[model samples]
Target: MVQSLNSNVCEERVFSNIFQTLSKDVHNFLRYKYGDNLNPKDKVQEAFIKLWDNCKNVSPEKAKSFLFTTANNMMLNEVKHQKVVLKHQQVKPKHYTNETPEFIMEESEYMKKYQRALGNLTEAQREAFLMNRIEGKKHKEIAEELGISRKGVEKRIYGALEKLRKEIDGI
Candidate 1:
């Protein structure tokens, strides 16, 4: 019957639509749950295929739940079979007390040069840089406090950095 044929076509369209819509969401969900080590795309594909095979029993509304459940179970089985290895690394703390006289002189000179460079920056640039670096204010916070746009704050900070780099490099 034409009605039966049309119904079949409609059902296929719904299945295809569900696959396209839920595939990305299902992939992201799996990726978030299992991390980047597992192949989420493969899981998504397998889930959709399972959904297609059982399309007779699943409505379009329940398709999302079915896909997520299938992907989760697949991921769990994969995780269970795999051995988890965690490597611990010890980081050595830096000690600053072992400086030679030449090193101390060089560090002091660098600080003086840095101060000179800060003195050379434009007032706007200097204020923005200090607020960001010294006062530790975010761009948005500095922008609000200075009555400037975020972009303006960013430009000022960038300009200050460029000027300081040039001065410090002796260019």
Candidate 2:
């Protein structure tokens, strides 16, 4: 009975080792490609979860291939989602430098009001606004660097603009 138990434990250890080795390779491959787009840690977690769910059917030899395929599909889905979201965001139209403004006074007033409003904002809000507007960072990038949510960055920018508009009206 002791010999039989030892054999069973050895078999289990071998199976566990195989899964671990294959999963590690799969994570490395995905990290090389999509590391910048999605968190590598999250992708690895998802791959392991799938492996766990399908472990009974997945043979040791085929496990690596399965993990790679699953990780690739996940990265593709993330890329497609980001593309759809970015496509919907409206970009400001570019004007030629030679194009003459019909009213310079309005532009000056707007700048003055915007500056005053910016001065009144909280330090975090002002920093976020400047990073987005003056420094030209995407909301996602700003959020990551500032350690804030994307929605928070969006809110700060919108709030800043609204305050500027109100200040202009008061002027």
Candidate 3:
């Protein structure tokens, strides 16, 4: 088949050639700019799909530029969405309960103190205590997981409990 110099890239062979030549370059460009956490491969694939969608308007000479621009724009959109999600996550929503407002306020205040007390505990104590209480693991189970003796786990839990009780009243 004879191809003109200014022919569009709607042909199968032309599109495939463009994908083969530019996919890796576009993928590496995105990965280097934004880590793999942003799914650069997905962006690259989406960009090529977009290029194929608009292939009638994209000439073979312009395919590389179109792929790179489209890929970069897609990644920017994803990064923007991630930032919005993270921003929303940092905000706490109000809760609806049957308890009185005063009781709920006091409960919220106590919860704040409880969290502070948990943070005040030593890292070792906090880890073991959380594994036992929050995760519902037995002392022996926690000891095995943490590579410590059962007695050591018990001591950490005890110390954590003692510190928590002192720091937060009515815990």
Candidate 2 lDDT at 83 equals: 88
Winning model by lDDT: 3
Better of 2 and 3 by TM-score: 3
Model 3, 15-67: lDDT tens digits are 88788888999999999999899999999999999999999988887888898
Candidate 1 positional error at 134, Å:
0.9
Q: Write the per-residue lDDT of candidate 1 for residues 27-144, one digit (tens) a residue.
A: 9999998988878899889988888788777666667888899999999877865644222224456776788999999889999999999999999999999999999999999999
Tens-place lDDT digits, model 2, residues 27-46: 77878887756776677778
Give candidate 1's TM-score: 0.43
The models' CA-based lDDT, in order, is 0.83, 0.75, 0.92
If ranked by lDDT, best first, what sequence of candidates would result? 3, 1, 2
lDDT of 2 at 154: 93
Give stretches of model 2 more than 4 Å off: 1-15, 91-171
- Output the TM-score of candidate 2: 0.43
**What TM-score fits each model?**
0.43, 0.43, 0.54
Which RMSD values do the candidates have, in order? 12.6, 15.1, 10.9
- Candidate 1 clashing pairs? none
The number of the candidate with the highest TM-score is 3
